[model samples]
Target: ETLVLTYDVIANDGDTDSNTQTVTITITGTNDGPVASGSYEHQIVDGPGADTYDDITGQLRASDPDHEVDELTWTLPDGQGQYGTLTVNPDGSYTYEVDEAAVNGLTDGDNPVDSFTVVVTDPSGASDTRTINISLSGTNDTAEVSGVDEGEVIEAGGGDPGVPTTEGTLLAVDADNPDNRFQPDSGRGSNGYGNFVVDEDGNWSYTLDNDNPEVDALNEGDTLTDTFVVRTEDGTEAQVTITIRGTNDPAVIDGDDSGTVVEAGANGPGEPVAEGTLSSGDVDNPDNVFQLEMGEGDSGYGNFVVDESGNWSYTLDNDNPEVAALNDGDTLTDTFVVRTEDGTETQVTITIRGANDPAVIGGDDTGLVVEDDAENTVGGTLTASDVDNPDNLFEPASGVSNGGYGSFVVDANGNWTYTLDNNNIAVDALYEGETLVDSFVISTADGTSRVVEITILGRDEPEVLHPVHIHRHDSGGDLWVPEVEGFDTGSSRPSGSFDRSLDFVANWLRESSEHEGVVARLWAALKPRDRLVYTSDPFTFNLQAGTFLHTDPGASLVLEATLKSGAPLPGWLYFDRETGEFSGIPPEGYEGEVHIRVVAKDSDGREAQVQFTIKVVDEQEVGMLLEETPQDDTSNEQTLRGKAGFSAQVAAEAGGNDLQAGARALVASLQALEN
Candidate 1:
C-alpha cells in the first residue's frame, strides 16, 4: 500500500515566495467492524373462513462504511421467537414464519413482535452486532358452533309426561379463541312448540310448552316436525329440529246454553219460538263434528224439540188449563239435558214468560126491588170467561152497600143477591112512588170488577103503630163484705207487706190519673230500640208493657210476645211475661235479624203491639271495648250478668225507690217460684 501528501508553504518575511511539495509513504490496511442497520415489518393475513397461512418474508437492510453491502455477511444469533422462527442469511435477507398451531390459535387483535440479533462482518472476520425486529399485524378469524340434530316430544293431552324432551347438546369452538363459550342472554330462542336455551358452557336444552293450544291441534297418530335456528355470540347459526306426536282428546259440550222466549198467546200462539244454539266439539273426530242426542226432551206446559244442527224450539200449549192459568209477568223454566254422540252432556234451560189476556163478564147490570115485597131482595147470576185465567171465580163472596139501604152477598159461581133492610133509615124515609138505588162492586179472580145497581121502589103500608107504658124504680142497698182467713190480720210480715204493696199498686193504678201517665211514660221509655247483637253473646231486651186503663182494678191483663210472623219464639229465647223481658244467648253459627212483636191485651180484648228487631251478627258490629276471647258454644252469662247488675246499680244510685221495690218484688217472686 502507498501513501502521498500534498502541501503549500509560505514564509512570513515575504509574500511573493511560495512552494508546493509532495511526499510518498507506505502503510498496511486492516479490516474494521462493518456497521449494520436494518428494520423489517410484515403483516399476516387471515381471510374469512381461512385457517392456514404461509411464512412471512422480510429483508434485513444493512450498510457497511468499509465494505459493500453484498460483502457484509449477516448472521442471526438465537433465531427463535416466542411465536415463530426468524432466519437471516449472510446476504442481509431474512424470513419469519409463525408456528402453524400458533397461527391457528390467533384471535382478533393478536399481534406478535419477534426480535433477533444480526452480526455483520467483513472477510477479515471483524463484526458488528445489530438487532433486527420483526413485527406482524393480526387478522380476524371465523368462529363456529355445533347444532342439535334431532329431538322428540309428546303433544298435549298425550297422557302423563314421565320424562322431559331431550335433544342433542350444542357445542361451540373457536381455534383463535380457545376459551370460547356460549352467551346465554343472546343465545336463547323460541318456536311455537318449545323454547331452546344454551348455557355458558355450551350445553343446550329444549323444553316443550305443553300448555300451548297448538299442541292439541294435532290429531291422534299425527306428527309435527319443527325446526329453529340458534346463533352464537359471533353470529354463527345452527338448526335444531323437534318432532311432536299427538294423542286422543275427549269430546266437550258447552255448558252455558239457555234461552228466554215470551209465552204463546201473547200474539195468539203464532209460531214455535226458537231458543239458542247448542254447541259441542270433539277435537279427535273428523272436522270436529258433533251429533245431538235425539228424542230426549220434556216440558211440563209445552213441546220442546232439538234438531241435528243444534237448533231448538219450544211450542207452548196455549189451550192447556195449567198453561192458561199463568198470570202476567209469570215465568216457568223448562230444563232439558242435551248430549253429543260421544255421551257428553250439558243442560239447556228455556224460560217462558207469560202475558195476560183480558177477561169477559156477561150478565145484567141493573136490578129492581120492591119495598113492599116480603123478602125485599133482588138476585141474579153472572158468567165470566177468561182465556189466560180459566175456572175463574169472584174475589169476595159477600159485601155491603155503601148506602145504608141494603146489603149484598155473592157466591164463587157469580150468583149474587141484594137485600133491602126494612128498618134502615134511608129505606123507612122513602115515600110512595119514591125510588132508591144501591150500587155494589163485584170482581172476578183476575181483578176484573163491575158495578151493579139495584133500584128499590117505595110502597105504602096501612099497619098502625102501638105504644106501651114504661115504669122506672130506683133502689139503694149496702153490700156485705167477707175477709179471707189469710188476710184477716196478717200471716207473715213479708206476705202481709207484699199483699199491702199489691193492694196499693192496684188502687193507685185504678184511681190515680198520674199513675196512668206514669205507666204510659214508663212504657214509652222502656221500649227497646233496634239493637245489633253478635253471636255467642247473651242478649237481654226489656219491652214496653203496660196495663189498660179500666175502672175495674182486678181486670186481667197479660202481655205476649212472638215473632212478627205469628210463629213461636225460637228455643234459644225466653220471654218473661212478668218482667216483659226477652233474654237469651244466640248460639254459634247463628246470624240474622230477629223481628219480635210484643202485644199487651186486657180482658176486654183490646191490644197494643210494638215491633222491634234484634240483628244478630257473627262479628262485632261496635268497636271493641276489651280484648276478644275465643268464642264457643258456651253461654255468655257472665257478660249478661255484668250488664244487668250495672244497670240495677245505676238505678239504685239514681234514687228510684219504685224500681228498687219492683226489683225486690221480682227477686222474691223468682225465689218463690224456684222453691
Candidate 2:
C-alpha cells in the first residue's frame, strides 16, 4: 500500500486551499523539559567576627528542592576593606581571617564591619548565594555588679525583714562596694537609709519601731521574736533570727521585815517567824528553819521556831555549880535548850567561876650554939614566928651543954643560966675566950618551942703551977738514962740531993767550965753511929781530954777517952808504941748517942774496976783547953805542981771562968794525996 494521503486543512477562516491540494501530516514530541518553579533555601552563618583571637570559621547550608548543587563558593563583599581574607570550602563552609595588620587596625577607635557571600552552583548550572554580616565590637571586659536591689519594702507584721534595705537594728551592711561608691545620706551608702544612726566607728544603727516595737522596753527574761539582717554598701543582704525571752519579777512577802526571834521554851517572846516571811522573793520557796545563833556561852543558846506566833521562855541550865554560886567578880553561864512546836529540843551552854584561901606558914625556925673552945664569942641567936600564928610563944624543951658545961636551966621568967662545971668553975673558965656553944629548946605553955645557943668569954691566962724542988747541994749533974745501950745517958753526979727543991746544980753545971771535959766526952758519945769507926791509915782523930799529966821525965802524957761498944773492942783501941799512951784525934763529924763498956784487969789477972758514962765537950771547948794550959814540966816537983794547977785552971775555964775555984780545989787534992 504505498498510498500517500494528503489533506489540506482549511483554516478556520476562509483560507484558500487552492494552493495546496496535497496534504502531508507529521506529529513529533521533542524532550524540551518543563522547568519546575524552583524553591531554593540558603542560609548564611557569619564567621566569627574577624578580630584577633576570634573564631572565624563559619558554615553555610543551601538546599534546592529541584536541583542538585555542583559547587559551593564564598565571596567577600566588594567594599570590605582589607579587614580579613575569606575562603570557601566544598561543604559550604567559609573561613575568614583578619591579618596582623588588620587586627592592629581594629584598635579602640578603628572598628569595622565585614560582609561576605557564599555561592552554590546546581547541577543544571543554576546558582544560589547567601550573605553574612560580621561586625567587630570593642574588647573591653568587666565584671558585672551582683547582689543589688533597687528598692525594698517591709510588711507591717513582718518583724525585722532581715534584709539589707536601709541600715537599722534589723539590718547591718558592709561598707565596701564593688564600685567603691558611698553616700552616707543616701540609701545606697553603707550607713545610710531609714532612721539609722551611725556611731563614730562607722557601725550602723536603726529604729525597728514597727517590726520589733518592744525591743527597747523588754526586760532580761521577756520574750520576743524578730529577724535580723546584714547588708553591704552594694546592697547585699543577709538575715538572722532574734527571739526575746521573758524576765523574772522581784519576789515579795508580807510585812517587809527580814529577821525574827524565838524564846527558849515558849513560842511568843522569842519565837521564830514563818519561813516565807523573810523571802528571797522566789516562787515555790523552801522553808527556812529557825535557829538560835548565839546561846548563853556561845551563839546558839536562845530558843528558835518556825511559827511566827509561838511563845518561848529560856530557863538556863548550865550544870555548873561554880557558876550557880557566882560572886561579884564571877562570870557564869548555862546551856539553852530550845523546844519547837513539835517538842524537839536542842542545847547550848555557858560557863565560869572560882575561890581562894589566905597564906600560911609551913616550916619552923631553929637555933644553934657555939662550940666549947672556939676563938670567937657572941654567936648569933635565931628567933622564929609562924606566918599564920604570930602570937604563938617559943619555949625550950631540950638542951645540950656547951663548952663542957651542964644543961641550961630556964627560970620561971624564961631566962636561962648555964653552969659550966660541977666543981664551980665558971663557964668563962671552960670557954677559954671562945664561943661556948649551948643548945637549948625553949618551950611555951602552948607547946611551941625554940632552940637557943649561948657563948661565953674565957679567962685569958692559963691555970698552971710551976713544980717545986728542994736544993741539997751546990754541984749539979742530973740526967736520965735509957734502958737501951744507944739511948740517953744518965745525968752527971751531983754534989748533994735536995728534999723538995731542985739542986740547980745541973743548970749550973751546964754553964760551968769545970765540966768542960765531961761535956766534950758526952757530946762525942752522943754522936751518930756512922761516925764511930777510926781510920788508922791516915791517923785522923776527933778527941777531947779531961786531964793532962806531967811525969818524972821531961815529956808530958795526954789521956784521950772515948765511949764505944760492940765487937773487937780492945783491938780497935790504938796506942802509940813509944809513948805508952793512945794517940790520934777522934773524927770530926758525929751525931746522936755513943755507948761503951770498960773492964780493967789487975796484975794478978783479977778484975779490978768498972766505970760508966764519960762526957765530952764540943771542938770549941777542947781548943780552949789546949790553948789555956801550959805545956807540962817534968824538971822539978814544984814545976809539976804548977803545971797541974795550970791545967786545972784551964779545965775550969774551958766552958767559962766561973768554975775556976772548983778547978783549984781539984788540983790541991791531987797534990796533997801524993805522999
Candidate 3:
C-alpha cells in the first residue's frame, strides 16, 4: 500500500509557489489476495475411444489488488491425484479435454470421476482456489440376461413364461439402467430353435414357428445346444449357452371310411368284405408298428383283423342270424381302433354292403318216414326261400333211394312235395330192431345243390291180410275177431304196440259173476292176435323201434295204436320198451319155426288170439343169390331174362327197402319157374 504527496507550481510562479504543497508517502499493510467471482464444473462422457470437452475449461474472474491479472497464473489443485494434465490461460481460464482412452482403461472398481481445484495466484504468491469438479463416467456396459438358471425343455411345440412350466425365460439387465433389451446374436447357434423372441422390457420366450425350417424340423424327444451373446450400447456381452430339449407329439391317421363293399367267402356278414391299410403319419417314431384293437370303442359295431405289419380287413358277424337274414343293399358297419407303438388309440369306421345272397333251404338235413305197412307212410317235405331275391325257386336234381325215401316234387310256384317211399332196400337191410338211411340230392334254380338224407322207419305188426282170418267162437254164437291194436281203423298202421285191452280182460276176470266162468273163458279166448307166415331163414323185414342211424344217441321212435291188440307178432319181432316201437333187426340165432301169438280187440272190443310162423332159413345155408342172374342191377333199364325190368328211377322211387323186397319177390318167382 502507498500514499502520494503532491505540490503545484504556478506561472505567477513566485506567488503560486506556496500553493504547490509537499506530499509525504507512508506504506500500510492490507490483506487483499486474489478474489475469484466465478465458479465452474465439468463432466466428460468418457466415450470408448475418444472424447472432446469442447472448451469445457471455464473462466473465473479472479483479480489481485496489487498485481496485474496478466501476472496471475492459474494452478490446478490435485484432488486425490485424480487431476491429470491441465492448461490455464492468462485470463484465469483452463481448458479441460478428458483423455478418453485413459478413462476407458479404468477398472470396474476404479473411481470413474476426477474432481480438482482451479487456483488463481498473483506474483506476490497470493492465491485463491475454487473447486472445479471434473467427472469421468462411462457410457454403459453390455446388457445381462438373467433368469435362465436351468436348461429349457419344451413340448416341441411352445411354452408360456412364468406359467409353471419346465420352459423358462430370460431377463436382460444393465447395472446402470432399468430399460434394456436382449437378443440372440446372429452368429449364435440358434438354428436348432431359431431366434427366440425378446420384448422391449427384456423378456425371452420360445414358440413354435413352423415357418422356420429349423423349428419345423424339431422332433419329439430331440435336444439342441446353442449359444447367444447379449449386448448393450458399449459393445459388452454375456455369452450364454442354453440347452434346449424337445418332447414327443402324437401321430395322425387317415382312413377311407366311405367305401362300400360286398361280402366275400360264402357271402356272410362275419366274413371279410374289404381289404386295405389305413394311412398314417408321425414325425417321431414314424416307423413304429400299429395294431387295430378288437373294436373301436363299440364292440357291437363289429371288429377288424389286422396283420402284424398293419394290413387290415373288415368283416361282419354273419354267424348271427340277424346278420345272416340281411337282404340285398343291407349294410353292416364295423369300427376299428388303431393303436400306435406308444399305445395311442385312434378310431376309424368300415362298412359292408350286401348283394344277391344265395337262396336258403329250409327243413332238416334228414327226412324221416315210417312205412306203416306201406299203406299209410308218414314223411316230410322241404321248402326253400331267398332273402336276397324274392322270385327264387327250388328245383329237383337226381335223387337216390330204393323206395323207402320220400318222393320229391317241385312246382313252378316253388312249392314242393315229398311222399314216403316204403318199398326201399332199407326194408330188407333193416330187421325188426334196426334202421337204415338213404341219401339224395336236391337243387335250386341257381345251380346250387344240397344233399338230403332220408331215413325210413318201420315195425312188424300182426300180419294183416285183406281178409284177416282171425276169429274166436263164444258160447252165445258170437264171433270174436282179433284186432292188431297197432293197426289203425283205416288202412294205415298206428304207432304204439302195447295194448290197453289187457286191462279190460283183467278187469273182466277180476269181476266174476254167476256166469263168471263163461265170461272168463270168453275173455281168455278173445284177445287181439295176428298170424304171419314167412318162408325163409333170417328174413330181412323192415322195422323200426329206437333211434335212427345217427351220430347222436338220444333219438327215439314212438308208436301209438288205436285198434286194441295183444302183444305184436313176437318171433323175430322185438319191441323197444323205451321207444314203444318194433325193432328192425331180429333176435340172433332165431332158428326154424318160431311162433308169435297175439290177442287183439277191435275198437268194439271184439277180441281174439292169433299166431304167426316164421320159418327162418340159415342165410349161410341158403342160395340167396342167383347162380348167374348177372347180379340184379336196378340201375339198368333192361333185364337179365330178356324181359323188361324195373328202371333205376323206379328203384330209387321204391327206396332201398322196396328194392330189396322186389329183388326177393323176383327171386321167388324165378324159383317158382324153376320148380
Candidate whose lDDT is highest:
1
Please report the TM-score between candidate 3 and the true structure: 0.37
The reply for model 2, stretches above 4 Å from the true place, is 1-70, 74-225, 229-237, 242-257, 260-675
lDDT of 3 by residue, 506-606 (tens): 01111222421223111111112222323342333322211122111122222222211122355445644343333333455554554433232323322
Compare the candidates by TM-score and give the number of the best one: 3
- Model 1: per-residue lDDT, tens digit, 1-675? 334554444435457765554444445555566776655555555444436667777666656565777887888888998768888888877777777556656556777766778787877677887776655555544557665657787765534462346656667676565434656633323457777766666566677766667666666688766666655555556677778787555456663477766655533453336466766676655432445444423666666666666666666666656556667778777667665554455677767677664467778656888886887888887778876676547776665553336788977878889988776534554556766666566777776666676787877655332211011113421111112111112122221122212111111111122311212211111234566788889978665323222323234547787776455788888999888778999899999988876665556554444456778889887743222211111342112111112111111121222221222111111111100
Query: Candidate 3 local accuracy as lDDT?
Result: 0.43
- Full-model lDDT, candidate 2: 0.32
- Compared with the true structure, model 2 gives a TM-score of 0.20
lDDT of each: 0.57, 0.32, 0.43
Ranking 1 against 3 by lDDT, winner: 1
Model 3 residue 370 CA deviation (Å) reads 15
lDDT of 2 by residue, 204-285 (tens): 4333333233432333344444443344343434443333342322223322232222212211122222122222222212
Q: Which residue pairs collide in model 1, if any?
A: none
